[model samples]
Target: MPNSLRPSSRAAASSARSASLADVAALAGVSTGTVSRAMSKPEMISEATRVRVMEAADRLGYVVNGAARALAMRRTKTIGAVVPRFGSSSFPAMIQALEATLAEQGYTLLLSAPEGRREKEPDILRAMLERGVDAVALLGTDQPPAVLSMLAAHRTPYVQMWAPPGSGSDAVGFDEHAAGAQVVAHLAALGHKRIGFVGGRSKDSERARHRFEGLALALARHDMALDERAIIETEYGFAEGFTAMQEILGRRTPVTAMVFGTDYLAAGALAALDQGGIAVPQALSVASFNDNDFAAYLHPPLTTVRLPIREIGEAAGRLLLARLGGEHFEPPPMHVELIVRRSTGPA
Candidate 1:
């Protein structure tokens, strides 16, 4: 029997979708072998035939059986991404850059959001390996020791993102601590002291914690004290900012200025303060990290420290692509910028 007489690698996938390669071949007006050759090794087939076969496959909505291909060729041509969650602004941008870069070199991105930070890194690595991912990208470098050991054992190429100084793995990120410090310094230089901190939980994000620490360092430099009640932890959203502001408002001594870990939180604070009938910059000054797209749209606009998310994403894509191409390059520490805007003034 000809190789095409046997089931094609995509047969199982077709069955799952209730379609078949015969369906593709018949629709293409070509032989089964022609369809197989066109789909598997397009370079060996005539351009007209390849086009016809691809069009038919597209019309049929054929799905590639990555598992079978991985078994046959020992390559899945896919990279895995493990992040905190999907649909977030930052992760999606990074994924887009990575996917575009991989597609340019004939690869795909297989995404998995493990709900939250993986507590069992070993199991997570095992799951990706089981799926035959060529590489994996993790959101941060705060993995458990066993997870790091698992990666070393598998000898897979992995990249860690959003890291601080002295990262353990190959990484692409900026100094979160320095970013926080920059915001505090910017606020202080504008004559605002007695700062409050609003941010995400310290346990989940080392970067968030570092930002808070940077705030402390900057305040210390100015002989300022951040009140105990002024530090509020939220779940990295706008709602958290609102809650943090409520707590701040309830304080005995009102804060003069505030720095937040993210613009999302800052936006919440702005709304909360407005609802409380408090004036901004006159009664309270506010600054935040992550000079996100919406930062400039607020009533007074936000004074924010730029996170360099796009640059980091682009750089991450380039790094992964170069590695896939067998080229060696060191990952660089990207920098953050402070964008002084109207949200902050004398306090």
Candidate 2:
């Protein structure tokens, strides 16, 4: 029988032996090294030839051994990122940007979250290290000492995202304190004398602490004071913001405006005000940091600080690639802008 009529020969060979690079090379009419290059470093190979090799490998059910490849290349071509929480607030946008940038350069991303527990970050990072990730990106510079020491011991190249300039570490982010001061300035300009703040726990979030500090500084500048009772520290969640707002209202403090550390929290506060029949920008004005996607769609539109989240993520990815490429340079600090919407007015 003709070879086309009878698949016995090819089927018998495929069944008898596990496919190897040489087998794929033979089927694609390429050399073994070319086949290897096509799989590991496809950029160096022409597209047509790469397609031929891939098709031959698929037909033979050939699977590249990542362990073997790593051993040979001394790289897994994978990058890892550790954040406080995934799918929370603005992190999803940052992660998407990071993933897209890395994919363009033939790298994969491995993400991890500490589930709001800073103490667990070190263990999570150690696990990523053990998995042979090429490099790592941390969310902020406020990492546990153990985590910093571990990264130092491993000599891993890392960059911190959402951190300020001159943070004494490789980072790509904006200044949270300045962002907070901007909000206060806006409120003060609107004739708001009494402003309350709803935010997350200062101990768990450096960003929140800086924002609160900035608020206090700006309040003093405006000859105003933040009522100790008006400042509520809660978790970084919508429910937490709602409850904090409710508690502040219960205190009956003469707060004409509210500044939230994040837009997510501000959103919750808005919900509470709506439910309590409080007219925003009339009875009270609201401002927040982080102009997340939902901010513009909120009732009355949220007035917030517009952080370059996606740009920061993309910059972080580029920094990692530069390190891998043996290029070194300090990145400039990103800037934040104030977005005035319907949420804030004369108070």
Candidate 3:
């Protein structure tokens, strides 16, 4: 056969080539042993040499075969994370706190933001398990059955954040239902009998469902009912809140107050009320959940329920680490506070 008809050795090699420690070592002018040390025991190597090896690996798009390494060493030194989305300030800060805590013990965070795609969690967790992540950290308590099944099948240790009942023993979070009820109680105390709610659709977020249920229960206790037509469930976005507010107003229920599921949603509702020439507290009292970073800085500081998010993140990390280390850890109860700010007042 002619050279063109047969397999070309050069092209075949080019197509089959994948960067390995030997390749990285060659490019960085270091031994393969030194490259291995830089990757697995960077603390034992000089910082300058480690940086050189890392740069070379990056240039060659090299990823250590974590599965193979884990089988040999029995640990990946990684924690896999799954969350709804990182759009708001909360998820990033929460994850950052967890990362900081894990880093102390030489663990790295591998994250997946299913963002509007919560259904992908099972697949993400499966991939992480296959890659040999040592543990997993989940955002909400109400994980899907498939996700729970995959974890159980692999016997992968995991912990839940934003804790409530139904998350099993490894839950670490505050009272989401209590926070929602507290918002309503604050408004009810202010003599607002009629109220509307704007938040993420419950189908998309387990927390959203808990919050609404708590608010509804509180409303019933106060001799007030959540009007089906007045409830506006939308995306957890500013623009979504704006549109939701418009829809609620169009219902003509004439609710005296409005409760939002998140501070971002509350901020958007405030803008819509302003554009419509309605003054907060005087015309419509506004309050929300998650006293997130911007809650206290809104045009009229928002009244919201405060969640100890950083503490939650840190505790979840510590809890996971303890379990991984074969140490006992009991999660302390976290409380939520209702903050009364300028955005809300009397009916």
Candidate No. with top lDDT = 2
Stronger candidate by TM-score (1 vs 3): 1
Candidate 2 has an lDDT of: 0.84
TM-score between model 2 and native: 0.90
The whole-model lDDT of each prediction reads 0.76, 0.84, 0.83
- Give all TM-scores, in the order shown: 0.82, 0.90, 0.80
Model 2 regions lying over 4 Å from their true place: 1-12, 15-19, 58-61
Cα lDDT tens digits, model 2, 1-347, are 01121222543476578877777776777788988899878999888888888887888889888788889888888999998866446888998898898888878999997678888888999999999888899988898899889888988888898887677647888877678778888888888888788887888887777778877887898898787789888877788888888888889999899989888899999999999999988899999988998999998799999988998899889889888889985666688899999999997
Query: Each candidate: RMSD to true structure?
Result: 5.0, 3.1, 7.7
Q: Flag clash pairs in model 1.
A: none
lDDT by residue for model 3 (199-222), tens: 778887877888888888888888
Candidate 1: Cα lDDT at 31:
84
* Candidate whose TM-score is highest: 2
Better of 1 and 3 by lDDT: 3
Query: In candidate 3, which residue ranges exceed 4 Å CA deviation?
Result: 1-72
lDDT score, candidate 1, position 38: 86
